[model samples]
Target chain A: MTTTAPARPAAGRSRRPSGRRAARWPAWRAFLLLTLPMVAGLFVFKYVAIGWGFLLSFNDARGTIALGDWNGLDNYRRLLGDPAFTRSLVTILLFTLFIVPVTFALSLGLAVLVNRLRRGRALFRTTFFIPAAVSYVVGALVWKMSLFSGTPSGVANSLAYLLGHDDAIGWVAAVDPPLYWIVLVTVRLWLQTGFYMILFLAGIQQIPAQLYEAARVDGAESEGRLFRHITWPMLRNTSVAVVLLLIINAFQAFDEFYNILASNLSGLGRADGRTPLIYLFQTALGEQNYGAGSAGAFVVTMLIVVFTLLQGRFAGFGRTAEEEG
Target chain B: MRRRHLGSYVAVIVFAVPFLLPFYLLIRNALMSKRELGSLDWHWWPETISFQGFADAFGNDAVPLAHALWNSALIATISAPLSTLLASMAGYALARIPVAASKPVFFFIIATMMVPGAATFIPTFVVVGSLGGVNTLWGLIVPGLFSAFAVLLFRGFYLRFPRELEDAGRVDGLGHLGLYGRLALPNSGALFASLGILSFIEHWNAFLWPLVIGQDPEFWTVQVALSTNLNQQAVNLPALFAGALVAILPLVALFLIAQRWIVRGVLLTGIKG
Candidate 1:
């Protein structure tokens, strides 16, 4: 997969061209030409639009580019007082806190299982990985209609009935806050853990086979002993990366919630349905309240940035202890 | 040691069951006729198997699902190659050429990784919408073609590439284009192919942008069409599964075809520093 890049050995040369010649071929001209399009196309799209959105948080319709009107900090002031917005923020926090740890634990356990597989390793890997390829629509549809559908005809409800729970509760329309959160987390875990398992497996494989051999020779018979001696320490960084990725993904989650709950939000019920992203979309696009949406987006972005930085700091991601060794 | 192998199989299967069962049920459900599907009772196996569901799905006139598949395949083929080519170009420059501003450029490129696509969706929609690209294939294909992640992968691959080949090319009086074509691209065909498959799968299975842009069924990608087809009031459960099955088949086939390299590439993301 590796490809050698073509070297321009003359790159460092200060080609001292005379007045007209220098004008014709600038020293930094080539670099500018090569990078400007990418910068203009991507950087402007990414950073500039984001910056504009941030500025729009403080602007009324005229001040913001999308829907023009100026009313400074009006959106922010309203956002600070908005109950639904506040609820979403709290819900997202609770959701992330719950989901990240669960997925981490799940991935770690699955990786350990895969690492132990003497055969059918590829089959197991493929089976888990297949769903990772399935689009959010398909996953959401299956989960909604088949897995957790409220109707008696649904698979989950049927199973629940079989298990002696006479109530075939509608998973999506459930009014209880905790129940809704559980459904969301379960679906997220089902979709996500496989990808993380692959990552964890990669980390597991990097733990030299010889170390496990040595552990076995030293009479490490139990799974706990094997993990303690040969697996856990090696997987620490992998775990960190997985946790960080999960946090980011969990915060950014929109599709599953959006699709699963597409039926319910007639604005009449409790708003636990809104993850911060969904809330932002609802407030801005659905409600035509762009200012509030921008504020929400900014808040979510800051929260994620802070969380990532804090996690990376603790993970020692930029430079790990092993790198020093 | 032999006992450990047996133990491993048991452990793997136990772990694999939860992930595998949903898919098992999905296929089982897909095969079941409407009478069986709508039944309140659940069974591991249906009393009979029929292609009724498949036929119902394929028979729909509103969605040119066959055309959606063609559109998806066409878009994927074009976008994957183009995106890979762009990534290779950027990757080559970042890895090979030593410019004064390369670090900053590389940093900027990598920083785009954290820019969530959801945040950009509205503005991107506006841009595409204004350009009259809405309900068009270019709307679907063009946006997905530009990926910072792909470029990063190519850059990582390039970083590991041997320098001697490029030097040898330079020794033979080849310029930048020749060096890339003759020395770099050929050596990296496996990576390119893997990348191609990855990008193709992503574009093929794409839902969000296509959904946002392709408002009409005529322009729908297979994925968008499948989901849209389902959202109607007259819920065609069997037809929905058939559409879904069609959409997933290409990706599964591609994965099977390129399983070795795809798995390796997947593994590489972690193992590579």
Candidate 2:
């Protein structure tokens, strides 16, 4: 594979005596030229800032983001002592526990159905996947204002009226039994299920057709049996990846929750449906308590890291492809 | 077989209605006048197609809807291509170059993918502020001009690229630069388009960071502007709907046009190691 000896001796001994240096220059130049900016940006914006945030979490940096007044462990103590912050953490955990499984099941089921179709698969796929492109802000607003608005003419209210419940329910503002979860869960499902469905479809397609044919020939004629024996096992990697993504996404549930619940004149939705990110956002930006905000951010990050490591331990997420084989 | 097909159609239709209804309502309400929107009667189809809501949204005094839209377009336009270019270059290096340090560099970049945005949210704000990027469009654009996901995607594409073409080019006396410029980049049209579309949509639809950084209405993106309407005292429902519709129109159009590439991009990210 090395044509280096002939070309180097014939062309480079007189013009450029250091042939190896010349060959290396282009790669080094290109690598630095292409990667320098990204590497620098990540260093300053991500790594340095992350370190700064960790330090600031221990300081009493309020009304500004600078670091001067050192108040050791006060922010952490304050945040943990606050019931609101603790409640937000519990809210996110419950939300994650509920949303991840439902999203997983729904997306996988949709993918299986779509993949099995012999006709109009593309149409069904497109129709389902289009919402994934819609921004969370837009989807949340559409759901909040039109579909679940507390007005007689709103879609949910209209349906309620037709079904003999004559009152227009304030679906979002309701906190007793927490009807807002229905709104949050449904909007997320509509926006994201398509994305994971596409993932599952890709996974399903990668399964060898011969395996299914062999199963059928072996008298495993039922679709359920074939799926259990072949399709389920084949999609293990995709399923693990999907669950990992879902857990991460569920923890970082800010956009929809903020747009739907916090956008009222009364106050931020601190009482109900508040996730950790929302709590951190209000703490950091809304009130400018940068220390507590940074502390909350790290707490949430640690939670995510723990979950990811646990999932990886169970699912073999870090294993090399050769090892998996 | 016929019965099974019928059952599939029924299940699909039942599942699709929820996904389709919001879009239908968005378009329906956007086309309706304020009076029609407020009326008790639900007009499934608007009897009169009035552009009043759109006009109000464009003519919004409190929040500059048009300026926000322009800012959103500018930021997304500049950041998407720049980010994709940088990611592709780095990706090419990691894929083709035999440098011993390339392996560690690639791993370092991938490791950044796991850091949640929340962890970096505050410090980034402080850094951007200190650099005088607060309330500036560049504040939003600069921090987002490089993506680890894009780097991974481009690396995946380039790794699978057949080296025989590059070998042929070398035989024809084409140097590495010439080969990358004339051969490799030209064959990566789909990869570029997919990454570009993804970056564009992401920057365009971005909410939290912009909301935090852009305090001035002059620098507000479309998402921030739309959110302001939600929090205002006198909420104009029709105009809000129109704003939501306008905010999502370009993305929906892009997805429809480049449907295949977008789906392929999603699949690639999920399936790859």
Writing each residue's lDDT as its tens digit, candidate 2 over B117-218 gives 754577778778778988987898998876777788887787787979988987898765676677777888888888788788889988888988898899
- lDDT score at residue A201, model 1, on the 0-100 scale: 85
Per-residue lDDT for A286-309 in model 2, tens only? 788988988888888889999988
- Candidate 1 lDDT over residue span A1-325, tens digit each: 2132223323323432435444333424544554455556565556665666666666664222464566777887788788887887887788899999998898788777876776677888887776766777777777777777777877778877889999778877887644656567877787778778888888788777788788888889787988886688777777777887788778877767766776222443257667777776566545655566667777777788899889978877454433332
lDDT of 2: 0.83
Docking quality tier of model 1: acceptable
- How does model 1 score on DockQ? 0.36
Indicate the fraction of true inter-chain contacts that candidate 1 also forms.
0.25
User: Residue A168 of candidate 1: its Cα lDDT?
Assistant: 74
Mark the regions of model 2 whose C-alpha exceeds 4 Å error after superposition. A1-19, A263-266, A317-325, B168-178
Among the numbered candidates, top lDDT falls to 2
lDDT of 1 by residue, B1-273 (tens): 788788778777776776766676677777888888878777777679867878877778887788788888888889988877777777766665556566677778778777667655654554555467788988777766556776677777877788787778978987555666688878889888877777777788776677667777778888777766656667777677767777777777777678776766665554342
When only the first chain is scored, the TM-scores of the models are: 0.85, 0.89
Candidate 2, position A318, lDDT: 52
